[model samples]
Target: MAKVRLSAAAWGLSAVAAGTLVVGCSVSVNTGHAKPKILKDKLGDTVATRLAATTGQPKPDVTCPEDLVGEAGTTTRCTLTTGDGSTLGVTVTVTSVDGDNVNFHIKADETATPAAN
Candidate 1:
């Protein structure tokens, strides 16, 4: 049988690595915050639908964060990517929440997209 020896520096590094492997690990569960019923994705979809209906044009692409912790009455601005690969601003407001029904408002702002050469 052969005996193995480790230097002091090697022993210290091994200990640190072992400690990191053991104590530096953690588990994070993202249940999300207890937010209002109105979320950004649904709100964006609503905006797209309403805009299409009001303008009689095709529904533009609407994108929002996957998670939005909204208050009962709060307004936030989200970006809207149109069919032309240009971005616009859409303001969203969560007006109220009644029972299981949630109410919100969306206003599309007309900001011209710069010409791409």
Candidate 2:
């Protein structure tokens, strides 16, 4: 996991960009077949990449508990851990699906949670 330091205001601004960030993931899906999903690592990497681009910061550490289901309205929670050990909650929601492409929205929490002692 990579960690990047960020000011509170920078986090806030990133949060705003997060709200409107839509990432499209390409994966093959067959109707009436097994369910499709974005793997945990892939999801985390995508989020980190987008966040880094938005904030002009190094790619931060992000972890997802489970794979994100590739279905409209499906969602999963991922965490972004900063260099100082603070964390921000990120919600990834599937907004729409088209053929083999999955489009989702990423929204970060308005504030960070201080590290636990």
Candidate 3:
């Protein structure tokens, strides 16, 4: 049998190298257009459908620009046409842009009031 040995220093270096490599390989989703995509996604599917059905609002008209982008702590405006022929403004704010994952906050625009069915 062959035996191999590594020094403490060597093991420490290897550990550090592995950690660095992992950190480097970690990826994050870009805020570019991610903001809009998230908004549209939630709205076009669950959020809009639920809101419209419950609120007696017309099918929501989700409007988001393909070019809108943002960074953590940044916000962008989005709009949806409501049932009452009124625009329901919303803000898509980026909370985190981390490794293939993005965290955000979506809410009605500060000046807009949400209508309850």
Candidate 4:
């Protein structure tokens, strides 16, 4: 019957649409496996100073989590607390560093001050 034929065609079209969606949504895995450098706050004074300058805030007294080290050239999560009792949590990618000055890209949650309104 025509109704049976139409139903089969609709099922076939649905299957094709599902296949197309799955193929279109497929993503290739990244091949790069470079490991990122793990820097701890207790390692040395350089890391402490660098973290302080990078965040423009004082270093935190708490221990830094090991999982903060992300893949190289990728965003790494970091937390810094200033002496004034303010806390900053950020995701940053380090570009370069020289002495106490560090250059980096911040991903989000960069807070400075409340805007005057």
The top-ranked prediction according to lDDT is 2
Lowest lDDT 10-mer window, candidate 4? 22-31
Q: TM-scores, in order shown?
A: 0.57, 0.77, 0.43, 0.33
Error of 1 at 1 (Å): 73
lDDT of each: 0.49, 0.73, 0.43, 0.36
Mind giving the per-residue lDDT tens digits that candidate 3 earns over 40-108?
454334333433443343445556543224357666655655444345454555666665355555454
Candidate 3 regions with alpha-carbon error over 4 angstroms: 1-59, 66-70, 110-117
TM-score of 2: 0.77
Clash number by candidate, in order: 0, 0, 5, 0
Residue-level lDDT of model 4, residues 1-107, one tens digit each, is 22111222332333233333322221122222354343444322333344334434343232345432333354455543333444334344545433333334433
Best by TM-score: 2
lDDT of 1 by residue, 1-117 (tens): 642333334333433333333222221222233544545577566665655555444565667664333445666776656434456555666555544445555655544343255
What TM value does model 1 have? 0.57
Ranking by TM-score: 2, 1, 3, 4
Model 3 TM-score relative to the real fold: 0.43
Residue pairs whose backbone atoms clash in candidate 1? none
| Candidate 1 vs 3: which has more TM-score | 1
Worst 10-residue lDDT window, candidate 3: 19-28
lDDT (Cα) of model 3: 0.43
lDDT of 1 at 101: 49
Winner on TM-score between 3 and 4 is 3
